[model samples]
Target: MKKLSSKIWSLIILFLVITVVFMSLFTNFLYDQLYVKDSEESMIEVGERLQSNYQGGKVTDEFVEKVEDFNMYSTFNVFAVRNPKELSACVPFEIDYDTLIGPEERRQLLKGEPITKIGYEERFEREVISVIVPLTDQNRLEGIIYLYYPLARITELANNEVIILISSVVVFSMLLAFFVHKGLGHIMRPLNELQHAVEKMSDGDYKTRVNVSSKDEIGKLSEAFNEMAAAIQSEDEDKKTFLATVSHELRTPISYVKGYSEAIQNNFIEGKEKDDAIQLIHREANRMERLTNELLQLAHSNRDQEKIDVYPMVISETIRESVDLLKNQSKHKEVEINLELDDSLIVQANEEKLKQIFINVIENSIRYSNKKSLIYILLKASGGNAVIEINDQGIGIPKDDLPYITEPFYRVNKARSRADGGSGLGLSIVKDLVKQHNGKLLIDSELGKGTYVTITIPLMEEL
Candidate 1:
């Protein structure tokens, strides 16, 4: 179970959204404040103009005409002059002026104090700001001049500002999201490759690698991963060499013991016969002990490595050596070993492991081949790989067992394998060694015909 790394752009996008939201709110607040101040100033100026034009005279049609002209130029609606005993109104039509002006503000205007107030006027069903000014003639209080101005225009402007601010914020957010997604992808691309490499390693693909050239943290991580894989690969190669050496050493002693044991049992010498038999037995016991130890070492070498070593070697040499090693087993059976090889057939591989691969193939052939049967070794270079095929005229393996031949400890005929002294590890070892060389091992067999094992290794030049 693995988890994907968190993306950096997600955090950046969140921060951008918060900042944009805060800035939009602040801008709207400032705009509303400025608009309110301008509206108030316009209302005050209109009220002063009316008071200046008509303050010295009594109410007349001429003064009403002046108020109407001022109303056309300004936002003022309700204009009235209220004296101590009577009220002279120039509202252009009949209306309740008292209701439009709140009582407290009206009282302040009548007391010679100019007042401005904002309230909803019921007659118009709208909100308005009113400005009131006092008029005086010859040192006596003549009347109060009141002006009403609707706040709808300011409200509409503020609404438009909010719409524009919201639209800007949305646009900015979308652009930020796009850029953030792209930047995060750029940063995480190497990490994604590293992750895939790790998965391949888990599945025993040790040669998996990541190529990321950068001076950043992700690049550093890729470098570290490659170093670790190389170290593991080196250790693995050392282990394989150690196992091959040990296996080779044990084989000589095993052959000697088997040879002497048969010689003594057949009485090649007459005197001290029992002693010779005991000595032969001792040698055989010791040989088996050494062989078992080598097998264990080979098994330990098969553990997972972070990387693998791949090189080129002659396939013909490997097959020839394997056939010569097993030639003794073919003595009584009259098995004919043949080679069909390309002169320059070379493959990328571990040489010793490649030798072991053919040893396993030929040994299996010797064990199962019918008396006087032929075992053919064929080699070809094709499609960037050197293909080595071992064909044996033997008691062919069962179809069901063919698929599991490469699995450790699996055998088609367990009783036969035991009788043949096989530990059921040959094909498994062959498969592992071939994979380490970045190659494939294929087995094809029919019940009555014969079995063919094909080892396909990458060509040296291709590597």
Candidate 2:
């Protein structure tokens, strides 16, 4: 089954409702106009028949009998009045004379003015169309005749007209709806194709393109979608090429460092000069090891479903261990690393990875701090998480370099970084490890003041 879009469905429903309502109103208006004219003409004929009876001087008992009999079969009420006082004298019908006609209406009839009124009457509980005419003999007003016709027949005729009009309208409306729907489908065929093409493109089938020949908005949209798919395909190819080149370039140095370090360690050289060379080789090996580890971590982090092992570990203990490992490196500077933590504070994390996280952050602090400057470590639970902050007063990173500080191999000052024996992968590893624990790593630094690295991890369930 095909599903219609909300926009199209709404338009269809709106169009159908409007067409129905408009046709109903138009049909009612046309029928009312036709029935009004017809009823008025019928009323005139009834008035003429009453006038002819009066002019023949048929104003006797037999004539009154005929009028009384006429009221039983016909829908008109006939009355013959000589004057306002003798209104009941000439009329034989048992009529409610006063209730039916007012004094002003009688006066107008006597003065040779014919009266025609069409209105609703409360007494009859229905509408009446009355025609009153003067009966004259020898240029004198003999009497006035009233012809009252009930509007029931006109109402019936109007009802029939409405029924017929509605039936015709329904039939026509159905036909119109069918044709309109078909026309709309024809117009939207290209849009439907364009939509299918876009779906294919979204599913990575960039070769799909819409063949919209019309010079309209939909056509322009088709052209733009094709162009976008082409551009995305080109970008995807370029990214693959760049990643391949970067992988090849990074692996070559790592291979050399590993090979030479292994050769030196295996006694491939000897003597004091060889010892120095071996030490340099070992340093290069460690540097390469750091680089390779960062690359692997980066690849793992980029995966959508990388497995992470989380557990409880003491925050203060991790910091103390990391500082002790780098204590010899900071001996010449007399750098003092201090911890401000609660003894029982713990965090949920991967234990080994969290240790590496602490090592990278603390080592970066030692490398950048001024000689003899103190590195402060603070650990506490704040806002439902265990927060560890490392603050160092050093030549802080530049403002622009701060954003890229955690990118692998990115250095704020390359010369200074190399002097500190950093491969520029420390902070990047810190960031990845923090993320693996479902934590946040924040860096705040001033140009000359110092830099602060804050790592926050969710507190363990045991508290």
Candidate 3:
């Protein structure tokens, strides 16, 4: 349930904290291994060097005086003593002889072996590192040489460096967090806007949009979101327009049928007038039937694109067949359809749908053509496509209406009687069928000149 930015910031802070802790631990390890160990070894060497000065003789004042004089100038506390109790006067705390030279340590000291000690010494009130070397003469315990240094002085060498390193790391971490926070803010701004826009869209505001500020992935995502919003808004508007137009088209016919049926049932008209009323009702019923059928076909074409079965066939065959089927109607209109086709031009398409495309376009041309005019149909191969052009020498469509000619129920001449012009869904059906065939449909027309329809479908590859 946590937000993305919060999770990211948490991870960043965790990483920095872990990094600083690990570095601090590693620095302490290095200080112990490199500095403290080296100081211990140096103390042992100094004690051994002082032990070599003892010759085969009894303990003497001259040797002790020489050790005290060396200790005055050196960092180590050098001691040459005959007994452990004599060294007790060097510090304030009372010293126990057994604790200073334990049984095991006494044995090693008598054997002329060096002993190193490190830890807290109550006598010194701090941690101390000391090395003891026995001054043995002729295998007899004579005296002992001692060299000790405060452990704090050895550690003090690197404390300042370590402190500075940790301080710098803390400061750097703060700065990194600051910049990362700002960067995340910049990056998530577009995403936040997109989230709000999506919420608005879910609540029926399809027109909501987000701004695109950069060419990065986030910017591209914003652009895609805006495009999707625009498409949804357009689809919503189209649905509303479609519903309103459908209601208007059906209302008139329903009113006529209702009024006429009621009049007849009530015996308001008789004889020829009754027959005429029945005929008018029949005509309205037929118009309504045609509109419903066209609407169903349009919906099927949109949904059935993936279901259409396609095969290779000669493009000219479908055109010629469509022209032949429409011959009787063209004859009634006094319009002639002429064909100029390349018989070898083949395309991959559904045969029935291709024929439907041709029939719809050809019938449309015939319906709009001037009497006794010629409709030219041409088929040819161009750019690996089978291109078909249907041009009519009819009352052409206005330039402004050309763009919307393929919209269902759209008519170039809105005031024209539906019975004379036929339903305006023919070209819309043609367009969908052409698209189902993976073809492009282009219509160009000039008012009073003519309308030209071009359809291009991919040609089948020769095996």
Best by lDDT: 3
lDDT per residue as tens, model 2, 102-165: 7786666556667776767665666666666777665566656666655664346557778898
Task: Return the number of clashes found in candidate 3.
Answer: 0
Error of 1 at 416 (Å): 2.1
Residue pairs whose backbone atoms clash in candidate 3: none
lDDT-best of 1 and 2: 2
What TM-scores do the predictions have? 0.48, 0.48, 0.84
Q: For model 1, how does the per-residue alpha-carbon lDDT over 1-463 read when each residue is reduced to its tens digit? A: 3334353545665787798799778766765577656777777777776777774756666775677666666655745554522333443223445654467755665565677767776656666666767675655556666676666653465577788987897898788778867877777789889989999888867777899689788888999999888877777776776566556555655776777777777878566865776676686576567457546635754774325565667778877887888888878679999899886977666677778778878888878889899999899988988888889999998888888887655668865754465656677777777777778889999887789988888887742
Q: Which residue pairs collide, candidate 2?
A: none
Which regions of candidate 3 are displaced past 4 Å?
Answer: 56-59, 83-86, 89-113, 123-125, 137-142, 153-189, 214-217, 304-307, 421-423
lDDT of each: 0.72, 0.72, 0.86
Model 3, position 117: C-alpha lDDT score: 76
| Of candidates 3 and 1, the better by TM-score | 3
